[model samples]
Each structure stands twice: as structure tokens, then as C-alpha cells.
Target: MEISRSLAISSWIAMAIVLSIAPAGCFYLPGVAPADFQKKDPLMVKVNKLTSIKTQLPYSYYSLPYCKPTTIIDSAENLGEVLRGDRIENSPYVFEMREPEMCHIVCKITLNEKEVKDLKEKIEDEYRVNMILDNLPLVVPIKRLDQESSTFYQHGFYVGAKDQYSESKDAKYFINNHLSFLVKYHKDVEMDLARIVGFEVKPFSVKHDYEGEWMEGRTRLTTCDPHAKQTVLSSDSPQEVEDKKDIIFTYDIEFQESDVKWASRWDTYLLMNDDQIHWFSIVNSVMIVLFLSGMVAMIMLRTLYRDISKYNQLETQEEAQEETGWKLVHGDVFRPPANSDLLCVYVGTGVQFFGMLLVTMVFAVLGFLSPSNRGGLMTAMLLLWVFMGIFAGYSSSRLYKMFKGSEWKKITLRTAFVFPATVFVIFFVLNALIWRQKSSGAVPFTTMFALVLLWFCISVPLVFVGSYIGFKKPALEDPVKTNKIPRQIPEQAWYMNPIFSILIGGILPFGAVFIELFFILTSIWLNQFYYIFGFLFLVFIILIVTCAEITIVLCYFQLCSEDYLWWWRSYMTSGSSALYLFLYATFYFFTKLEITKPVSGILYFGYMFIASYAFFVLTGTIGFYACFWFTRLIYSSVKID
Candidate 1:
């Protein structure tokens, strides 16, 4: 116990030291807190990527032949931003606090044949141009009467729509060159200070006839003039994207003082998806699972107590010989199973994932990872996983030592590389697919190099150090001694068969969290924000409980069936949830998603496979430890000689 406590303390200190040395680019001091602004403060607008639900792809905003600055400098991004395909950069659009503009020309560009082709393809994919103003993403509010909420937002507006008003042999595409911006702000009652709270835009397609060539910030439009006692209205015949044709980009800005305070500005955006969650159904389902698990636990404990008492009150040694069932397998139970090294490796890897997820979720719940901090969640997950390699090494090496294995280094290497290697291979293939599509979703070579560097330099060294410490310590004593010859197992019931039993055991644990899984998947595939970490944390705890309980129940039954080979079986019993999870992902792709492109389909399954595999490791580790504890406690309580 003293050694274990010391190792844990050492791990914490090492983690803290490394984190303090890491960059703080992914965080804001007070994310979601108000940033005060003086009157007429210039608000620099930025452009993100062009997103499309149809293709499930995000292309750089400048990827299409759109208006651009003289030199398009890339925004500084963290590792997570690169991985998530975020390409943020400065745009020509600008605004000021408590100021408005009408019929402002951004740029005029002629569309060549190739540029026209690209634009049409984007429209075919139903792409929306995403823009950012004052760190707030521009959203187009869509009113709905289908649910309790009257309005939800579409993240960005479509570049153009085709063949809606006319049915020509060749689709006539109209581009949305006219943007009507609505900037919402909160004004301080005591002073003239104000803070930009919301940025929304209503996109339109307007064909403008200007008098002369205009330069940005200096030119005004005569077709839709602000001084003519009127402002621009979208033309009945909007600008059409055509080959060898010129198009003009224009915008209008309007400022409105909102009643909402600066601090509560994010309330509206968070509430946009309130209709997405069905609370009563989720709560009701979770309660049923909890109640059933409790009842099973109560009955199992009572039965175990009665059985132990009866077996212990033996009159003589002859009575002990006649005893059968779980007691009969006592000698073999403590014996190391075949291929115990593999089990240790898996359990250790699981420990690493478990630690990373636990810490990441805790931070998210405490508001350290707000949506305001773009890419913060993914960054935290990656960094936490890398730093947690120490725990993985320690756990696997310690387990290998207990299994009486001599090759501690081999086990440590497997723990450090095997799972990550598999994930990387899958990710690489999917990234290759995205690269072929020429989308921003493809991770850059430099970012990939950084990932490799982190794994090798920081994570590997930590693992080696942890393994050396863990392997040097004394191995834990087993509760029961193994016999020279293992006990023969009796014929087990069909339900106790490893394959059937493991799969069945997974059902309950999966049932505990499948509802929550829907929301998580929606957030990822639908490109929406998921900030309900508090509820998510609760579901995480519930999942842990379900996995532990189900595995313990199954282990007890296996032992009772006179089967002592419970090592691998116990891990798989809970880990089978991964299979179900992957299947559900496939189902979602077919039923919920409309991904037609083959590459997009491949990318979806590829990433989901990685996610499911991680889940397998995490839940599998939970079950293994729970079963280990149960066996130790039960065997220790019994009168074994």
C-alpha cells in the first residue's frame, strides 16, 4: 500500500511538471467571460472553412475562388485545430461597435471556366461558407414550429442554390454575394461601453451595377446607396455564377442593442439544440438500468453469503472434500492463465485510456474547456492521453510482474506502441482519403510530425520510467496458492459459455449509455457543439458502474460453473460493448446520415472504428479490475488450505 501510494504521488508530480511546460495556446484565461469594448472599436472578422453536411467535408474558406486579401496569412492554430480541419484566417469583412454600413463592396472578380466549375461543385455539395466575427461564429436563425423551441440556427449559409427558380437543361447557379450582417451587442447601463454578443447574417444574391471600379474601405455603391434615403434590397434576379462573367461581392452591417448581458451571451447558442435532447426518456431509461443492476447485486450478495456460511461450517475434512462448485476451482483460480502477458498488455492500455478520459471529462465539467475555446477539448484529449503513458506502463508492468513474467520490457513496449500503432494506421488511411478530396480535413505533415514527436519523445520516456519503477517493486501476493496440477472443470451451462456470456454481459452496460451515445454522435457528425459535460460526466460514472457490476456478476457465475479461466473472459465480457457501438455507428451512417460519396463513408467508419476501439479498452480495463478485486475478496474470505 505504501509503495502504491508513492508511485501514484510520483505520477501526479511528473504529470504536473510536463503540463506546466506545455503551451497555453488552446486556452483563454476566462473563456466565455466578457471582453469589454469601447464605442466604435474595430471588430476584425475572420473566415473559417466551407462546411457541407452532404459530403461531411470541410474545405478551406479560400479554397474556392472567392474574394481574398493581398496576402492571405494563416491564423496560428494549435494541434487540435489542425486535426479538426479548422482553417481560420483574416477576411475583408469588418465591423465596429454601434456602427452600421449598407451596400459596401468587398470585391469584384471574374469567374473563369475552372473557377465556375469549382463553384458549381460546391453548390452541388450544399456547402455553407463559415465566418467568424469577434470569436463568435455567424449563424442563420431558422424558425421552426415542430418543437418547443421556436428557432434553431443553421451554422452558415449556402454559397448558392441551383435550378430552384428555373428548370434549364444546364443548372443555373446563383451565388450569394450579398450579406446582410446583424451584430447584437450588450451595452453597459452606467457607461457608453458595449460588447459584441452575437453575430448573425442573412445571405442574399444581388447583381449590382456599379458606376466605376472601387477600392475596399474607400468606395461606396450607387446602385444600393445609403445616402439616397434608402438601402440595398436583394435583387429579384440575383447574381448568377457563369463562365467568363464578372460578379461583385457586397455586404451590409446593422447593429442592435440586445437585452442579454455579456456574460449570458452564449445562452442562446447553447439553447439552440435544447430540442435535440429528450431528457425524460433518457432519465427514465437510465433509472431502469440502475434499478435492475441494484436488484441483481442485492440478490447475488445474499446468495454468496449463505453459500459461504454453509461451506465454512464443515464438521470435518471429509465435508470439505465433498464441497463442489466455485470452491472446487480454488487451486486453479490463482494459477496464471495461458497467454497472461497479452491480458496484461490490454489491461495496461485500457488504464491509459481510462486515465485520459477521466481527467479530460473532469476538466470539461469544471468549465475549463468551454466551446469558446476552439479545439480545446480535442487538444486536452490528445495531451492527456500522451501524458498518461506513464500510468499505462506502470499498470501493465505491475500486472506482468504479478503474472510471474520475466519480459517486463517486452510488455511495456507492447503497451506503449501496439494500440497507438493500430489507431495511427487507420487514421493515416482515412487522412489519405481526405487528402485526395483536397479538403482541409487532411492533417498537415507538420502536425502529423508533432504527433509522432510527442508519442516518441514525451510519452515513451515516461512509460519507460514508470515501468522501471513498477517492475522494481515487490510483486503483490496472491490470495490463494496454485496446485501443481490444475483442477478439472465441470461441464458448464450453455449460458456460461465464454462467447455467449461475454456478449450478453455487454448488453447491460451498453444499454446504460446508448441514449447518450446518440447525442455524442450527433455532435460529431452533424457538426454541432456538445457542452453538456455535467450530464456527460454522470453518464460516464453510470457506464463505469454498469461495466464493473456486469463483469463481477458474470465472473461469479463462471466460477460457480467450475471454470477457473476467467482472466480474458472477464475483460471481453464488458469490452464487447465496442462491437455493439460500432454496429450502431454503421446503423447511424445508413439511417441518419446522407453521405453519398464513397470516401466520406470510409472516413466516417474509420474514425468511428477508432473511437469504438478506445471504448473497448477503457471499459475492458474497468471490468478486469473489478473482477480481480471480487476474486481476491471472495477467495480471502473462504477457508482455503
Candidate 2:
């Protein structure tokens, strides 16, 4: 007995050390970084550029009635030599409209000097020089140009000189002129015909422009066409040609602040200055302290005080009736629970799930499957659930047999499917709703399907095998036999009522998680990102302690009340954590979240219900088994009449 107590104390100390070090190793070690901390390549440069341009561009450019050209010059001398011309090759780009009336257009342009000359020759052959030159003014309909890009152009052009163009609100016209030049000459002109002039025609609100290495080589330009928009008549006399160029052109340009707003000063302040780690650490530490204190209290009361008191009581009772406290209820020791068959099956399945949950959480805390692994936690849990089915079948079958249940086959079949089926139905329904909403946070369809398959194939078979083994083995022999007739029930005090006791058992665990629950709620409902799995692992440990402590404490009182039918009560006492979880979630929805509609509320509670149900089962099993073992150990050692 002394050795067992020493071992338990040592194991608890070791577990505490391990839990502390595990998270420190994963998240806060001096030099070690977790695997999830690995960095990826930076975002593509083109996307960054587009994001910058959008922020800088003026609001007026998004409107219509583009600015008009001052003059049109066609003199060969005014026409600059075809500057550096190159084609922007094909690349993926997305042009989305920010407003209903706006359109976004994106396309690649190829330019060549040789092709422009060929088109000029063809136009010359078709008509006289003077006629062609005169007609050129009216040939390009501005209305047609507007219609061409209207549906495709959502947001206005993302120009560099935003300040210069702020007053005119004509930036879109300048952009359209550039686009028109590219469209007309692109097909007929060779790459050399178009030279990317200085800043006037720059890349627009393009996020990424990986215009390949070859494209970068085309950034060279020689000679300029200051008045390329003008048309000069090729008269027989040079004097006539010189007179035709009467208009002077100015490149009216302006600059404005870039539209892309960098992270706000306040946002940066919030991100870098917030003490998130400290908050989580403090909350987790408090919860752990509370859990440990509660557990220590329960251990003292139940194991230490109860043992001493019971021993004293037994000595006194022997002087009178020669019966022990436990022996007094020996007749009702093995009386079956109400709905014994169903109870056995559910408890058995719950036990299997409980073991799987423990193993999985331990592995997670140990870093085999951390948050960095994305869906690894769920994957591990699913696999363990399937593999642990046998425990469920065996426990359910054995318990049912001990209850003298005759429907072994029925019990086995129900045991195999009941819990899994409930979980599956809940999971599938939630998955369907998640799919409809296209929530990336929800489990994927394939993963859900795989879970179903695992339950039906792996878990069901193992359950059957376990049931067979359980059936083959003799039923567990109870330490005491149940009497055929019930004992006269004694009236319980107000505090001894099952409801009151169950409610009391929930307070400690709820207190441990209420603060943690806020952060969890934020992550789930507000679309916030939270990857503090290390902290969560610690909280899990605290939850276990709180549940066990609460259960043991309540169990002691029930035993003192001489209510020996503590099996389900022990389970439900700790299981009350689920109710607290639900209540906390409800509070989060009303006070912490901005959700307004009934649908969102339903979805929130619906999903929470499933999660809380699982949690209830897990915590209940922990309490039930802990108290069960403690009871068995203490009773086995006592002297009975």
C-alpha cells in the first residue's frame, strides 16, 4: 500500500515534469524550434506589385470620360524611332471587380517595328496618302474603344504617379491610350516597334509580373516618339508635310500616394506588442493549479480520510453488529444498472474510446503529431478509434454477461455500432453543413468518408472479435452478491441529492476551462487563426485532473450517504463538464461573437453539441474508472463481516 502510494506520487510528479517540458520543447525552448516553424518561400513579387499599385491609384480613375489628347502628330521626324519593343508572354492573372459597375481587363501585348511598317504600306496601297491621313482622325471610333474594355475593366488602371493625376481624374484615359496603342500595333508591329517609354506606360494593378528573364532583357529603349499620335500628310512638296504638323503635345502627368496600405500602425502595434503568450501561459497555469489543488483535496478526503474513518467505523461497528461499512451493502454490490445491457455496451465502447483518446493525446503532447501537421491530430484520433473497438466490445459483453443478460448476440451487435453510429451520424451531418458553407476549417469530405469506412470495417470487426472473446471468458465475479430484495431507502439530505452533487462536481472543471474557452471560441467563430496546440495539450491535462478530482470528491459523499449505486453517478458527475462546455459556448456566442442569425446559432451549438458529447464521454470514463479502481482497491483490503 505504501509502495503504491509512493509510485502514484512519483508518477504524478513525473507526468507534471513531462507535460511542462513537452510544451516548452515544442514552443518555447531556448534554441529548439518545432517542425511547424519551418519557413516557406516569400510571396511572388508580381502579386506584391499589384497590391501596391491598387492602394496608390486615385478613386477618380474608376469613372468614365477619359481625358482627351491635346494634339495628333504624324510627321516622320516627330515619330520617334521604334523604341525597345517586346511582347509580354502568357501568364496567369486574375482580374476581379470591386464594384458592380466596374470591370477588370488584363491581356498581353506583342509589338514589332517590322509588322507596323508592313501595315503602313498596306494602308498606303489602299488609298492616297492625303485621304488616308485625313481619314485616320475619324477611323478609330472612341465609342467602340470604350465598349471593348467596359465589361472586362472593373477597377481603374493602377498608375505610379498618383499625385500628378489626382487633380485631373483622367488617369483612366491615359491608361486607355496606352492600351489602344498596344492593341492596334501589337499584331502588325514587330517586337522592336514598341518601346516601353519611361513611366507613362507602366504595369498596372498587377499583383505579380514574373515577365520571364527574357522579358526583362527587353527593357532597353533608343529614341522617343514625343508626338506619335499626330498624322502628317505626305504631300509632293516637303513644305506641305511640314505645315501639317501644327499641334504641340504635352505629357500632362501627376503622382498620388500609392493605394496599397501597409499594415496599419495600430495593427502592427497589436500584433507585435500583444502579450498573447503570457495570457495563455497564465490561464493555463491557473487552470493547472486549480486542477492539482482539487485533485489533492479529493485524494486526501477519499483515500486518506475515508480510509481512516472507515477503519474506525468498522472497529466500532464490529463491537455492535460485527459488520463493515462496505460489507453492510454487500447484498446490493453487483445489482445491475437500469438498462444494464445498453449501459454495458455504451460504457464498454466509451472505455475503448477513452483509451484511444489518452494514447493519442499523449502522442500529440510528445510531439509525434503537433499542430504543424495540419490534420494529423484528427487522423491519429480516427485511426485509434478504429483500432480500440475491441475494448468496447469486450467490456460491454463482459459486463452484460455479469448482469446475466441472455441476448449476447444482440448486445454484441449493438455494442459494436451504437456509439460509433451516433458519432458517425453527428459527424456526417456536420460535415455536410460544412461542405455546403465551403469552410476550410471543417474536415474534408474524403477524410470524413475515410472515418466512416474505418468505423464500419476496422472498428466493427474488432468489436465482434472482442465480443467473442468476452463471451468465451467467464463473467467477472463480483466481490459481493446482490440481494433479490431491495433495502429500505434512507432519505437523503439536500446536498446529497444526485442533481446537486452532479452540479457541484462540474464547477471546478468549468472554472478551469472558461478562460481557455474564450480563445477557442474566437478561433472557431471569428475566423481567427490559433495554433497553440502546446498550450491546449497542457489544458487537456488540467481537464483530466479537474474531472478526476471532482468525481472522487462527489463519490466520497455518495459512499458516505450509503448510496452504493455509484457506477453511473460517478460517470455523470465528471461528465457534467459537457454541460459547462455547452454553457461556455453559449456565452461565447452571445458576448464574444458577432453572429446574429438563427442559422449561425444553430450551427454553432450543433457542432458544439457533438464535441461536448465526446468530451463528456471521455471525462466521464476517466472519473468512472478512477473511482471504480479506488473503490475496488479500498474494499478489497477492508475486513468485512
Highest TM-score scorer: 1
Error of 2 at 411 (Å): 3.0
lDDT of 1: 0.82
Query: What shift in Å separates residue 585 of candidate 2 from its native position after superposition?
Result: 0.5
Model 2: what TM-score? 0.56
* Candidate 1 per-residue lDDT over residues 482-591, each given as its tens digit: 89997777787888888999999888878878878888898898888887888788788888888888888889889888899999988999999999999999999999
TM-score of each: 0.94, 0.56
Which lDDT values do the candidates have, in the order given?
Answer: 0.82, 0.49
Q: Give the TM-score of candidate 1.
A: 0.94
lDDT of 2: 0.49
